[model samples]
Target: MMVLPFLVAGWIFLVGVYGMVTSRNAIHAIGCLAVAQSSTYVLLLTVGYRRAATAPYFTDTPLRTRVVDPVVQALALTDVVVGATVTASLLALALQVRKRHGTVDPDALTGLRG
Candidate 1:
């Protein structure tokens, strides 16, 4: 079960990277980048997983009881927010590039010497 998450995360990340590398459109590349960034969430969740571990809350459990790492969970949540923000900003930039250059293709945009 533990290995499954890692494998899935690796696959997702690799696929996203491949898409980004092969994509011809700027918007598609940004979407691929967002997909790659999402893999971090799965990885972080897997890291926080604990066999037979209870929640981080102290209620109904002793202070020393085994519990999943709250820090990892917090980091994962923060990463989600950061990823969304980055994706939105990148997409907005791509939109502006399309409007200014009249094309979203990276190859076509290369001629923008000015």
Candidate 2:
């Protein structure tokens, strides 16, 4: 029960990579990259989970002292921002490619040249 999500996330990450590699269109490849990025987030959150740990936020309960790991959560937040920036940049490039070549096909865009 506890580790299932981790396993699933790992598989999802692999599948996303496969999709990205096999996709001919640049936009589809970018979508696969986003899926892979999401899998990393799932892995991060899954690894940070602890059984019987208290919520991340402070609580008034007298006996509850455990706190959810904040460092991993913060790292995940940073990763999300980085992924967003990368995706945005990639999409902009894809748009340029589409405008120049009239297609999003990476197979057709770059042929022995920039």
Candidate 3:
């Protein structure tokens, strides 16, 4: 059970990497990069998950029972925000590249050098 999440995350990462590598369009590559970034969230969530764990609230439940780690969830949220920011920035850059070059093809981007 513990290994399943890791395997899934690895598979997602590989698929995203393959997409990026095989993509001809800059926008497509950026999307693939975002997909690659999503694997981190899965890994973090999986790491934070605890079987039969309850919320950290001080309800009728005792303090000794299993409770998932809040820190990892927070980290995952932070990662998501960072990923969104990066994706937005990359997309904007890609748009600019497309406007300047009139094409989003990676191979035709050689003339973009300074």
Candidate 4:
């Protein structure tokens, strides 16, 4: 199997994490979180990829033909959906934070009240 895709995914994940760690604003952190979540799509696709493999549709292929894994593809799709949902939720929460606190800076919101 090729190692490049895995390396690329890892690099992307690290970049996102670094961005999240250094981000000051809540919106920026949410964007970084989404970027981090996106790396899973690349990882899943890389894991499911097969050289010279056809699509997962088995309607016309022979019994022994190589086909990419459908499960991983499904998982990647699910990851995308979940990522979008999480991002949206975080964005909404950030909006609420800005509305209530008048700022989205992480350092400025240290005294959050319940």
Candidate 5:
């Protein structure tokens, strides 16, 4: 069970990288980048998981307090937010390119030559 998430994340990361390398459109490339980032987020979140860990919260139970690792959870949450913001920014840029140039294909986006 613990390994399932890792496997899925790794597969997604590989697929993302492959897509980035093979994609011809700028929008597709950005989507691939997002996929890669999402995979890493999943991996980090899985790292915080334990076989039988309790939720990280204020509780009187010493075992519960000891079970959860706050650091990993915090880092994962921060990364998730940052990744989302970056993905949105990249997608916006792609949209702007399409609007201004009328094409999202990198090869077709040749700028005016002097």
Candidate 6:
């Protein structure tokens, strides 16, 4: 119910976006993109968080007890997996670009104009 976590997530997202927008190198941009993706973890956790709530496992907890949303937690986990995959693919593409163009600078990759 706290607003601080949500604000923190938004701040993290904006920072990542700013870094991406200002990044000159492809690798830096990829890192920034990962940072941006990380904000979703914060946001998802915030959304699912409950004060004094138990884990989703109900093995020992009473049925009336509050528990965090399992669906949101699953979504967060899936987001992490997808983010890592996307980051890896982008890095591989960047490596290929550097190998072929001898540079990772977005502004210098004029060969991509075709």
Best by TM-score: 6
In the predicted model 4, the residue pairs found to clash are: none
Ranking by TM-score: 6, 4, 3, 1, 2, 5
Per-model TM-score versus the true fold: 0.91, 0.86, 0.92, 0.96, 0.82, 0.97
Model 3 whole-model lDDT (C-alpha atoms): 0.92
What is candidate 6's lDDT per residue for 38-104, written digit by digit as tens?
Answer: 9999999999998988899978887799999999999999999999999999999999999999999
Better of 4 and 6 by lDDT: 6
Q: Residues 45-66, candidate 1, lDDT per residue (tens digit)?
A: 9999999999898777887789
lDDT of 2 by residue, 1-114 (tens): 487988989999998899999999899999899989889888888888887887777667456577779888998899899999999999999998788789898667665275
Query: Candidate 1: which stretches are off by over 4 Å?
Result: none
RMSD of each: 1.7, 2.2, 1.6, 1.2, 2.6, 0.8
Question: Model 4 — which ten-residue stretch has the worst lDDT?
Answer: 105-114
The lDDT, on a scale of 0 to 1, for candidate 4 is 0.93
The runs of at least 3 residues in candidate 2 whose Cα sits more than 4 Å from the true structure, single-residue gaps closed, are 59-64, 111-114
Report the C-alpha lDDT of model 5 over 1-114, residue by residue, as the tens digit.
668999999999999999999999887898898888889778887887776777777656674354667788888889889988998898898898889999888878888333
Question: For model 1, which pairs clash?
Answer: none
Any runs in candidate 3 off by more than 4 Å, and if so which?
Answer: 58-61
Locate the minimum summed-lDDT window of 10 residues in model 5: 58-67
- Tens digits of per-residue lDDT, candidate 3, 64-98, equal 88898989989999999999999999999999988
What's the CA RMSD of model 4 in angstroms? 1.2
